[model samples]
Target: MRCRYPPGMPFYAYILLCNDGSYYVGHTDDLDFRLGQHQAGALGGYTAKRLPVKLVWSESFPTRDEAFAAERRIKGWSRAKKEALIAGDWELVSRLARNRQGA
Candidate 1:
């Protein structure tokens, strides 16, 4: 889902498509500022090394904990599952999950 805040401030779980075609999952309370940091290489970590990252997908949550949980969950996903999520293809994500379980 896109970033949608409810009434008060919202936390976000986000996916970044890196320059090297890799994916990075993270959570933050301020999406825009965090993105700016990543783009500017201020964070000095994974996204920094893979500079010029792009925000591919993000979802707003009511609480920081929820956003963090989503980030962790997405981080554990396979490339296909992550791509399915980016495409908003829940069915494909489910099928991929099932296939992984079966394997």
Candidate 2:
């Protein structure tokens, strides 16, 4: 969903599509700045090495804890699930989750 913040500072859980076709999940209060850091290699970590990462999806949360929790949960998701989320296909995401649980 689009990042819409409440009155106070907002937290965001975001997914980045890396150059190597991998996904990177993270949470931050300053989404634009954090994305800049990843793109510039200033973060010096996973996205740094991947270079030229593009933001695929992001959601805003009222609390940092909630955003962090979302990041952790998304990190555990399969690539297909992530793709479904990026495509705004909630039905596919739910289906994939159910199939994974059955597996």
Candidate 3:
């Protein structure tokens, strides 16, 4: 808890790179602790067997709901979309944005 997060915050959005080259998206109030759990095989549910995960990306949020929303959206995204987010490519993100306005 050395992290100086403002009090009352409850979640974060994070990405983990599995040993199989697949990416896992998730959200947690304590990123460090959660990562440790995954690495220790204690939280080995999804990332458990997919051990040796590396922290690839993370974003902190003030609320669990927001973080959960982000995690859900990212989980459904294609690999290219995930890569674009990792590369910080706003252009690519926009180009790949799904057409929701089914007009």
Candidate 4:
């Protein structure tokens, strides 16, 4: 069975601040459920072992593809870039990306 999102559903690109001071990036249409899963360790894997995860950042998109693309992009970013993003510092993120380029 295929489950389709309702009309006007919003998808999200989210970053979690793990207990060990690392970030986890992911996309979901249902943010609350996904967060709950991570918090309870039901999701398993990276966040499960880290435990005590907190919702650090998130951006909403009208479509799942946009949210997914954002997630993938963030996943490739360096810690500095991710921190810049979490701080909502677009200038810093661009600077970091450029500095890391061609290296």
Candidate 5:
């Protein structure tokens, strides 16, 4: 079932800095509620044990599928790519993107 937030807001692709200095990425329609669940350990998964996570970055999408797709793509990215994305270093991300194409 789809998340029921407003009528036509957007889904959020979010990244969190875990307490262990790692990162977690996910997508949800309600950013605040989802982040709260992660922080409260209510999700009972990776982020749950990695409590005290802080919201580091987020991107909005027109649909939940788009947000989830982006989250999945980012989840497979290298540390450098993730860092670059977190830092809003579009140039670095673009470089990494080009490198992935072996160009």
Candidate 6:
């Protein structure tokens, strides 16, 4: 069998655009398989109720630690920040953070 991951490989941090127009953030070692689970309602959580989730964003890290950290960080982000991320608007994200800091 082909190896899905080599030793010491990085994991992935991903964002899903749910049918409810909300976003979900998560981390996984196998992105395709994890996404499949969410799609099939195997995960049976947030994405389950909001099926038909589409992968809108993903970033790989050198380690699961980094991916997990990113997931937690993004989960704390506002909808605008997450939308900025999905839109690849780094400047908007930065501006939002700066505004948040000033508030």
lDDT against the true structure, each candidate = 0.95, 0.94, 0.86, 0.95, 0.92, 0.94
Q: Which whole-number lDDT from 0 to 100 does residue 94 have in model 3?
A: 72
In model 4, the Cα lDDT at residue 78 comes to 95
Write candidate 4's Cα lDDT for 10-68 as tens digits: 99999999999999999999999999999999989999999999999999999999999
Model 5 Cα shift for residue 12 (angstroms): 0.4
My TM-score estimates for the predictions, one after another, are 0.90, 0.91, 0.85, 0.92, 0.90, 0.91
Positional deviation of residue 66's Cα in model 1 after best superposition, in angstroms: 0.4
Return the lDDT, model 1, position 31.
97
Residue 24 local lDDT, model 6:
92
- Model 1: runs farther than 4 Å from truth? 1-7
State the lDDT at 21 in candidate 2. Answer: 98
Deviation in Å, model 5, residue 40 alpha carbon: 0.5
Compute the lDDT for candidate 6.
0.94
Error of model 3, residue 82, in angstroms: 0.4
- As for lDDT, the candidate ahead, 2 or 3, is 2
- lDDT measured at residue 42 in model 2 versus the true structure, 0 to 100: 96
Candidate 6 lDDT over 62-102, as tens digits, reads: 88789999999999999999999989999999999999899
Model 2, runs deviating above 4 Å: 1-7
Clashing pairs in 2: none
